[model samples]
Structures are given as structure tokens and as C-alpha cells.
Target: MLEGRSCLIPRPPLSSSGDQESTCFYMRYGIIKEGSEEEEEDEEKIDDRGKRRKSQDLVIASSSREIQIEQTPHERNDYSSVEDLIAPIGRDISINCLLSCSRSDYGSIASLNRSFRSLIRSGEIYKLRRRMGIAEHWVYFSCNVLEWEAYDPYRQRWIALPRMPPNECFMCSDKESLAVGTELLVFGKEVTSHIVLRYSMLTNSWSPGKEMNSPRCLFGSASLGEKAIVAGGTDARGNILSSAELYNSELQTWETLPSMNRPRKMCSGVFMDGKYYVIGGMASSTEVLTCGEEYDPIRGVWRLIANMSSGLKCASGAPPLVAVVNNKLYAADYASKEVREYDKVNNSWITLGRLPERHVSVNGWGVAFRACGERLMVIGGPRGLGGGMIELNSWIPDKNPPLWIMIASKHSGSFVYNCAVMSC
Candidate 1:
């Protein structure tokens, strides 16, 4: 009934010894005038008087008699309107309120206005969210080569990502994925050399990843916050390596780190108890390693832990499938289809329970075991189905044994080539 008129939503006046004026934000539609014919018609259409009162309560006339209609220059052609993110409420306060919003709503929020779109795309909001300890974990995985998808467990929704740029050589090659901050890095070999592909949630696009100082494949890698550590993998020459590197997603750069005491390949990395651990790898083609190394970022040193992964590895199996949740290390024993938890006191593993019966893996390949927030997620599907189906099962660790529950499933290739969990 108040169409085409601007309405003011006032903020409560601050209580102070000195007089403090209150501010209000403008809404595109104004309130219905009291005693107007439109109000009477609207009241009759709405049966609940409380509902009508609540609707009218949202708008308030200001005493200061100052009104503002904020507008910013249209820097880009795609923007429909160049208004302040939330006019009258300053940018800082507006961002603070936005920070508390669910990340799943970001796509819709970005579409609301030009300033919001810019803020979300600039990646500044995520950085601030990290600082404020607001994080949402989303699973990113690949079933078919060059195709990736993201699952938001909280919202129970799947987000399809842009297909990776096509390259026959890279498609057939072995690949590794790590999700750090707002970026997901996929490492693989082209016909002639190693290559890294990065997917960004902010831009919702893929681009060439920054190459490492020493490019290697089949490395042990894990991410904590905005940085990730990659260590102990074979070089391009297929020689096992002890060299390591650290990557900062914000700066999009990699720094060479001190090498481990031993060279290994096909190892798994995890962040536990505020440190990075490289567990269960092969020193050579014939020698399997049970020892794990712990890297202390504060001390800038790697401490070797003997027999740390003694019983976790299998003969000729993929590197120990491991994940860390709530600073506790856990491993998925694919051969036995069981889960084990690490005891830091004794440096041993305790059998927790079995993985989901439907979860299938071949020598630890094709399946993904990852820590999603506080839950352990197992991603895979049964073997030999005419049309494949991927299932996502998760269990929260507790005193009671793990109770695997199906979070979601979809018709896709049963084999999961690479997977990573990004929390920001």
C-alpha cells in the first residue's frame, strides 16, 4: 500500500550523559499511512491483528529529521544498484552482522546488492570470519576426472563447481588435493611437467595454481587456517624426496621448509594438537615406513616419532588413510574396514569401530576419509554397480563407538579420485 515511497527503520538511541542522536536505515518501500484506506484494506486481508502490528512496528519516524539515501559509483557493469552494503549502518557494523550469517546464504547475499557482491568476491569477508573464529566446513571431492563438487553438510546441499580445465595428460595422471582457506589446490602431472590447479570459492572459478619451489607429486599435505604444508613426495624424476614446502593462500606463494629426517613417498599429512604430522609412507619402493614426523611451526623443526604409525599401514596399500578432528588423529583401516584413534600419550592407535558397510575401497584408493568440522566423514560407494552412486557417511567421535549415518548420496562415479575439506 506504501509502494514507491522510502521508509525509515530507526536504530534505538544510545544512552549517554551527553545527548546522542540515533540513526536509521532507509528501506525501498515505505510504511502504510495510519488511518489510510490502504491500511484498512490490508488489515481486513490479514486476520491476525498481531501480524499487522508486527509489520507496522518495523518502521519508525526519526526525530532528528535527517534522511540519507546512500549511493556508490557503479564500478562494474553487472551491478544492479550501487548502494552501501547496508546504508546508515557503517561498513564495519554491517560486516559484523553479515559475519554471523550462515555461509550457505552467501550466494544469495552476494546477489542482494553491488557492495555485498564485491565484499564477498574480494575474499575479505572470509579473512575476517577466520579472525573472528567463524568457520563452516564444506567437503570438496572429485568422482569423474576433471569434475568436482562441494557438499555443505550443515545445509544439506550440494554445490557443483566449474569443471577443471581439460588436459588429457593431467586427467590420466595421479592427483592430490588440499583445501586451504578459500582455495582448493589440485596437483597433477601434465605430459611434460607438474601442474597445480586452484579453485576459489570467492570467484567460483578455477585457475592455474602457483607452482612450488620444488614441485612434487604424491606428497603428504595438510592445511591449517590460511597455510598448508606439503612434504615428502617423489620429485618429477620419480626419486623419493625429503624436501618440504609451505604455502600461504592469501599471498598465493610457497616457501621451502626444512626437510624431514627421512625421505618418503605416498605419505599422509594431518594437523593435530596444533602441529603437522606426516604419517605412514614408503621410504623406497620396497621399504614401507611406520615412523611419523611432527613439524612444529613455532619452533621451525621436525621431530621424528618412531613407531607412531606401526600397525596402521598395510602391505602395498595406499598411504595410511588418516584425518584429524578436534586435534585428535584418526585413521581408516580399509583392509579391515575399521576406524582407529591415536593416543598421544602412548603413541598407539585404539580401535574405535567399523566403517559403514557400504563404504568400499581398493587398497585405500578411491575412497576419502576426512575430518569435517567435528565429524569424521567417509566418502565412497559400493563396487561394481552398473550405474555408480557416491555415498557420504559421517560419525561424530565420542565415548560411544562411532555410529555412521548417511549424510547424503548422489548418482555419480563410485570412485572418488581426490577429496579435501575446506573450513573457513
Candidate 2:
């Protein structure tokens, strides 16, 4: 396993000679900027429980940080890197065409050289890749009942990952997954305690990440670029946790965050409008909670939001998967059989559309719903009735009279636990 480094990715440097090749790279891809002062050091406020907040990750996923590693064109003349390979194709069109490769090919490309590895790991690649209109997004799914698999929506194929690590008495379904930097993080209880496993796209291998401070099941989680937040789940003793924590992807560290006002489990989390919102869950195994809370990482505080009176009121009773797009929050309410968008300004929910029809669609447990690029997708099947096939359906809200499109389907022995998207 590769060790974590500074979360910041170094910007490519132009040769001092101002060579034609270097200038071409500059013309196609401009320099990326640093974060503003407010984003860097906004308000170092204390949490409700009186604890200081940790520093935000590099640039909260959109930008890099100050720790620079100079990779001038002349400095890399001796070794061939992905930059070198693409340097000749300085123009945007050819670079994007090369970038539109299969997801399974990234690991080999990254291993070509130091330059290729560094370029593949940087956020700049993602920005450039998207701008060129050649960015391809792949979805990783953990059935929780078996092993992990990734789907290339563009190619309509399934790629198997390494079997889920060490599963004697462990089942990973009650888990949460997110993409922080280039790794896929899967966290949840493994038999007795909460464990985390990190999957590297560059290495195409699985390794253990930092374990959770508290062992939890049915917790809320969301990604913040280079870092991620997970809150409110049931502990080993079946106690709902008010406790929350943050994961520093670069340091591979887990730090405790301020606990919530009330204990909750099986909650849904969505990062929207610069804050993290955790929705409806259960305080105990049997008691369902109607309230929700939003946390501002900048102010380091949590404010209570409106109570959830809509469908999927209980966490365990429904899947309660939440996602964000266009600065709005949308969730899959399995109980209602409809996906709803939450309007923070109006404090109301307007029905957006319905989930793909399934025999047992009324209940959404084991189903996974997440945002992919500009679209929202849900993956699950009505397996409860008997062994059935799984489905991947997606929606683009910008379209008039939005309709759900079934992207792919597969026969499976179990339901999905968690899902994440990577734009490579």
C-alpha cells in the first residue's frame, strides 16, 4: 500500500527556456489558483461542545494547497511521464481522446513512471479532463453481501476488484463509501468493530485505512474533495452515537468531531451549499427520529434543520440515500417510491421523480443512491422477495419532465451497501 502524502497536488512548471512544447501546455491548460483567505482561515470557532475545528483539506476538493513540488519540463527530460506522453499532444482535443480510456487502464498508465503517477494523482488532471469534454466517470459498488465491483457506464461492463478483505464473521453491507482524492474509502462495522478499507485506483489494490474511533452501523457519510465526514451511527453495544468524526485522507488519520445534540443511527448525509446536512434517522433500534441537523465546517457549528415529515422517516425502515446537485439536496425515500428534493430556502420538499420500479420498491434498505457528475443514480433490486437482478438507473434533472434511465442490470445474490463515482 502507498502511504499518504500532502493532500496538495503540485502544478506543472514551464521550462525556463520557454520551449514551444511548454508554451503549448500553458495555452491549453492555464495555471490553477490557490484558495481565498476566507476559505483558508475563515472563522476558527468552537463547536457546540467546545472543541476546536481541524483545518480544512488542501482546498476542499476544488483546488490544491501551498506545499509545492516543482516538476519543470526540463527537470523531467530524462524520464517519461504521463505528462511527457501527453506533452506532445499539448492541444486539448488529442489529450482528451487519450484520457477517454477504459477505467481498468488507469493503474497501468499511472505505473509508467514517476511523472505519469504524479499527473494521474493530481486534481488538475480532473479539471483538464472535464474541460476537454472527455472525462469518463465510473461507479464503484459494494454489494456488501459478496465482493466489490466497478461499472464503466460508458462501456457497459463490470470490473471486479480484490475480494473484500478478511471476512470470516464480517458482512460489509451496513457500510458507507466515498471518494477522497484518488482512493475509494469503505467504512463500517466488521463483525465487532468499525473498520475502514482504502482502494487505490492507481494501484488497483485494496488496503486498510485508519479505523474509526467508534464502531458504527448505519452511519451518515459524505466526501469533501480530499477529506470526508461521517456522523451518527449505532455502536457495538447498540447505542446510537451523537459522536461524529473527520477523516484526513492525506494523513490517513481520523479525528473526533463534536457530538450531535441527540444520538442517531441509519441517517443520510449530503454536502450541499458549503455545509454538511445529516437527515432523519433512529435514536434507538426501534425509535425513529424526525429531526435533522446541518453542520458548517467554516464556523465549526451545527444548526438544527426542519424535521423530516416525508417518507422514509426511519433510517432502517428505508434506504435514505442523499445526494447534492445544483446546490440542492435530493434523497431517495424508499417508503414513498419517489425521489424528493429538499429546499432549504423554502424548508419544504418537492417531489422530483420516482425511483425505478421494483417488486419490493416500497422498502429501500440495501439500495444505494448517489450523485454522478451532473446526474443522480440509484442501484438496487427487490431481492427481498427472492433472488433477483440488480439495476442501475440514472436521472438528469435539467431535462424537462425528467425520466429515470436504466443504465445497467445484473443478477445478484444480495443488495448494495454503498456506491461512489470517480471522474478520471
Candidate 3:
């Protein structure tokens, strides 16, 4: 069979003038042909040999049986020693084809050769995919303190991430998670200091996180593309912060942004209409702030909107349960078990419909409500026999009403400690 046969095509090396020569090698089965005007005589000589060899006669007996083909001096210049991702095809075309592949196949593709492993580990493929507006939404959530899992809604498959590094202090401390670019950052505290742990999709491994300009916990954060913004949380020494910082995943650096108008903690952040908004947080232990702040990255300004979270906040509840899909704002009201949509003009919330009947949460603490691409994802489970089940419920916002569909479920603790969505 033709499967037992292989060919290698190599282009000529660059000339002394730093220009690529036009010499090209074309190989099919066990025959090698030169692509240049000077090789016309050689081509005619091969054509004169018995109407060219038949295709079936070119098949090698076995994969280990290497066919001996004659080559010119340039073709024998050890070009195979050079690591090309996919031989015969140029690097640019190979990258384009790799970009079209599903992210789940990256592991298999990386195993092909060192060049492929480097390409996948360097995060270049994701960058190219982003430039082409190609993205897939992966829902990452942590049920146990040190365990995280990813769910692919489109593929209906679950991928368990590498176990987070063992740190007793970090495991016990309250943590926050954000997925920016291909990295998942988990923010928590060490024995006496705040620490950040990072999980990379490219390497499929966890590493120590890069420190932010201002280290804090219980902060409101959201990611858009390769950048993420964290704002208004408590810093060390139990002081509430009004500061904000922007994280660039590509550079793995954080930049200080203009502080918010007011100091607030226990808030939630979301990006809508190309702006970052912080909603429904506690200004103080006794004071619950109903105001929200909108940050315009282009203008470098934060505008305060009064009563923006009037009915969305609860005195003894967790942060506002908010998500954004298609640049539209949504919230899950744990108290009423309802879903609400934001009215941009009125700066108010409109009750859309009820949440999934079995999707239960405690004062918005245990459940995770996030935007997975074009769908709203509710991740939580109702308390049941034994431990409980973790269910992924999804719904697309429409003119009619919300209809949540149970897409996937698993047996686990009902509570979700942290969650984030990575789209790339």
C-alpha cells in the first residue's frame, strides 16, 4: 500500500545575498524531481525511462524500508536536519492548518516533533487564532480545593487539569480564579502573604503566578482576550482597596490602572460593550454599596453610576452573580432563583425568567454563573443523596424567555469554589 511509502521535499538554502534561491525539490512516492530551469534535461531523462514508473511499483515493502532516491548536490545539503513542523509544506502553511484544528488536539499535534511542541508550548498558535477571530469557549471550574476540571460545551467532553501544586495555606485560604489568554490564575494567600498560582493550558502544568502591581484578594476581575482587569479588593493588613491593575497575559506583566471612584470589596466584574464594570460590592462591613463603576480603557476613566445594582445586592449575600454574553449583561438572583438582564439606558435590571429548577445555590456562594461564548452557563447542583452532582446548565439569550438545557453532569461536591471561562 502507498501507506508504507514516504517522501521528503526540501528547498534550496539561501544565497550569499540573503535571498532564497528558486531551487525546489518535489518528491512523490520514492521519486524526487527538481523544480528549476537547469533541471529540464534531467527531467527529460527521467521521462524517457519507461513512461515513468507506475504508482503501485513505487510503494516501499515496509515503513522501515527506506527508498534510495538520487538527489542533486543542493537537495543533499542535509535539509532534513532542519526541524520543520510538517515536511514538504512550508512553516506558514503548516501553522495555518494547525490553527484550524481544535485546541483539544494540540496535545496530539505537539507530540509529532520538537518543532510542533515548541509551537504549541510557545502559545503562538493561540495568538494566530485570535487574530483570525477563531475561538472556543472552555469552562474551567474547581470543585475541590486543589482540583480543577474543564468542560468543552461544543465537544461535550471533560478534561481534568493537572492538580494544582500543594500548598496548605493556599488550599485553606479563600481563592479567586481568572482565565486570561491560555493561563488560569488562581489568587490566594500563603502562610502570611498573598500568593498567586498560575495554570497554563499550553504547558498543561501549574506554576507559581506572577505578582500583580498590588496584591489583593476577594477582588472583582474579568478577562477580555489576552488582557484581564482586577479591581477593588482587600489588600494585606485587611485594608480595602480602590486600586486596579491590568494584566497582559502575553507579556505576563501587570500594569496599574486608574483607581475606582470608591473603595469596595466583595464585588463582581464584567466586560460589556467594550467597557469594564464593577457591580454590587460591600463598601464596608456594614455598608453595602449599590453603585457600580464603568471603566473605559480607551479613555482611561471610571464613571460612577448610581443605583446601578439597587435590587441586585443582598445584605448578607455573596457578590453579585453576573455574566456577559454577546456584550449583553445578565445576572442570576439566588434569592428569587430568577435571571435578570441589564437595561443599558435605564441602568436597571429586568427580570427575564427563572433559573434551572435543579440549579441551587446558597446566597449566590456555591454556584457559578458565567458566559460561555454565546450561551449563559450555570454550574452547580442541587443537594442530593451521598455527596451531590455537578451539573452544567446552559441557555442562549433570546427574545422569548430563558430555557436552560442540562448539557453535562458529574458526581462531585455541589459547591464550586472558583470558576473562569477561557476563549481563544
Candidate 4:
């Protein structure tokens, strides 16, 4: 095939006014066309689509025509601080929710910061706040060395309170112990068995109360209204005695009551309705005790109730269960761990439930009560030789088992003679 050869193209030349002319090369791909200087100046100012265009200064750019839009800041004159934003303005909000929402508030944030700083500076606020929610129980017990110990259930710990001001003689020997409100009333001393010592848990302090009519110890102490009644225990010479005495809290004095049929010591006492029960303990001999009797404070007389299946002895660390529920008396034998629930209507002892776990040495004094959370907490015995407290719990089974969680263990000097529990 025959073909013509292509030729080279020349660009337009520059003008003479000191401005160099642009090299206007008419190019189509690689093919270009030569243009004369006059031809370029004569060409009209037209776009490739044959549209007229304004001069550079008068031309409006498409991008510039677009409206300049922007988002404004959320400025609120009504709210001067974060607290204004978070605080409830007549709004019904839960305390928890309000607290959460208010945490971000300026005042709350600042206060929290200041509190943390203060706690760090004090070094005790954190610990105090941590213990604010601890569940606790207080029980009084007497040991040999440690005259008295108070067991707390929440920490499962034992705290040794102040001993009697006097450390010697029969002052340490509390033949009978009774809990009146938060104060522990003990009757019987060496000089005169009728002397009484009242220990207040709130103050963790002690004070001397009035003495009984006769010198007595190891007696059964009970309460009727504001007055305290003491039944059989022992005489001044360590003899099994059948004598009863009464102490008037209002009068701050003592009176005597009719003695029991037989002399007894370490007997279990329970006040139900308006009557007092002196359950199985022991006579003058070391033999076991099975007989039980009740006394009416109103009538000033004693009536024999149903006796326990097993005799309760003082050697058992603590006395048998003496709980009054729904105006009925219930006794628990520590030796057998068998609980006898007394039906007031039938006037008899029936088998109830067993303790989840058995306890070790009981301190003749045991404390028990129904706590807020549907649980019954029981703290027993002083720390034998070592100063400590044993605590336990009871509840309906299949749920969480009632447990005795230890809160405190310490070197309490001695285990006193009597023990009882009272709520603060």
C-alpha cells in the first residue's frame, strides 16, 4: 500500500511588548497544526462547546457559587455549668439514676474529688465507709481470763469489752446473767451473792446496780417489764440454794420471790408472754436435769411445764436453746443438738430442726436472734483458753444455708462465766 509522509508543525512566535506569547500548538493526539501569529489574535474567545465566557475577573466559579454551610456550637445560656445539665429540674428520678446523672455535674465532680482527697488525707474514711454496711451481732459471754467478750456476727468476730472495774473476788463470778435491753445484768458476788453488776454494751462500760435480798449466785435471772427476777442458783457458801430475788429497775432496788421446789444451778430461763421458764439444768448434784418449771411474774407463782426429753447440764458449753417465738418457748440442747419447740397450746416439747453444723464448747451463755434478712444468727461460747468467738446462722433450707461466718478472732484473755446476745 502507498502512503504520504507527515510533516512537522511550527508554533506561533512571541509578540514585541516584553510579554512572551504562549506556545499555542493546535494538537490532535500527536497530529499538530501550525498557526500564524495574526491568526491566533483574530480567534474569538469561545469555549470548546461554542459558549461565550466572561473575563477572568468577572467569571463566577461553580465551586464558589455553592453556599458555605457549617454546624453551629450547642451554646446554652440557661446552663452555666455541667450541674445545670445533669441536675433534675422538678423531674421524678430514682436516687440511683439521679446520682449517676449528677456524677458528671460540676459540683458533684468537684465534691467527689474533694472527698477523695480528704479521705486520702485522713486515712480512715475509706475503712469506716467500708464497714458501714457490715452486718453485726453482739453477744455477752464470761470466761476465766477475759471477764467478758462481745461477739459480732457481721465480721464473725469477737470484741472483748471492758472487764468489771474490780478484777478480784466474787465480782468476777456472775452466778446469774440476764440481758435487759442492751445492758447485761448479773447477780451474785463473793461478799454477798445478791449483788448485781449491769454492763452496758453501748458504752462498753460497766456500773453497779442494786443488790438482791439475799446473797445468791448461779441463780436463774429473768425480766418482767423493767424489773429483774432471780430464781434458784447457790448460796454464799457454794451451797445449792432454793432462793429467788427481784430487782426493780425503776426503783433501782431489789425484792425477794418465793423459792423453787428444789435447789438448782445453771438452769435455762426464758420469759414468754408474761411468764418466766426455768428449764432443765441441774440440782445440787452433777447429775443431769430434766424437769422444767414456769413462773408468772403477775401472780408471783411457779407452774411445772413439760419437761425436756433429755436433761440439760451446765457442763455443756452453753445453755440449751431458750428462744420465745410467737409467745411460745423453744429450748435447744447443745449436748444432743436436738431442738425442742414448746407449743404454748399443748404445753409440750416437740422436735423441730437441727443446727446445720454442731458447735464446740459453749460458754454457758448463747445468743441468738432473727436478723433483717430472714436469717437467724447465733454466737456461742467465749474463746475457751484462746480469746475468740464462735458464730453461726440458721434459715429455711434449700435456699442459702444459714452460715456462721467468723468476723473476729483475737487473743481475748479469759472466757467469762456467763454469755448472752443482744442487738444494738
In the range 1-424, model 2's lDDT, one tens digit per residue, is: 0012211122232121111122112111111112334322311221211232222221111122222223333433434544345343333432344354443344444443444445655545554543444445668887645477777654455666666677543462456677775578876665556767788654456787778777576788877665778899887767778888888775778888887777888787878887887888887767777778888888888887656535556534764667886677787777767778877767778887677776244356567778875678887775455755667777877645458777777666446656787644
Best by lDDT: 1
Candidate 3 wrongly placed segments (more than 4 Å): 1-83
RMSD of each: 13.0, 15.7, 13.9, 34.3
Better of 1 and 2 by lDDT: 1
In order of listing, the candidates' clash counts read 0, 1, 0, 25
After superposition, the stretches of candidate 2 with alpha carbons farther than 4 Å from their true spots are: 1-108, 111-136, 190-192, 359-362, 382-388
Tell me the lDDT of model 4 at 385.
38
RMSD versus native structure for model 1:
13.0
Candidate 2 displacement at residue 41 in angstroms: 50
Flag the better candidate by TM-score, 2 or 4.
2
Better of 2 and 3 by TM-score: 3
Off by over 4 Å in 4: 1-138, 142-160, 170-175, 191-195, 200-204, 306-309, 314-319, 345-347, 356-358, 362-376, 381-389, 392-416
> Candidate 2 clashing pairs?
82-116
| Alpha-carbon deviation at 411 in model 3, angstroms | 1.1
Q: Residue 155: error of model 2 in Å?
A: 3.9
Model 1 misplaced stretches (Cα beyond 4 Å): 1-84, 383-387
The local lDDT score (0 to 100) that residue 355 gets in candidate 3 is 93
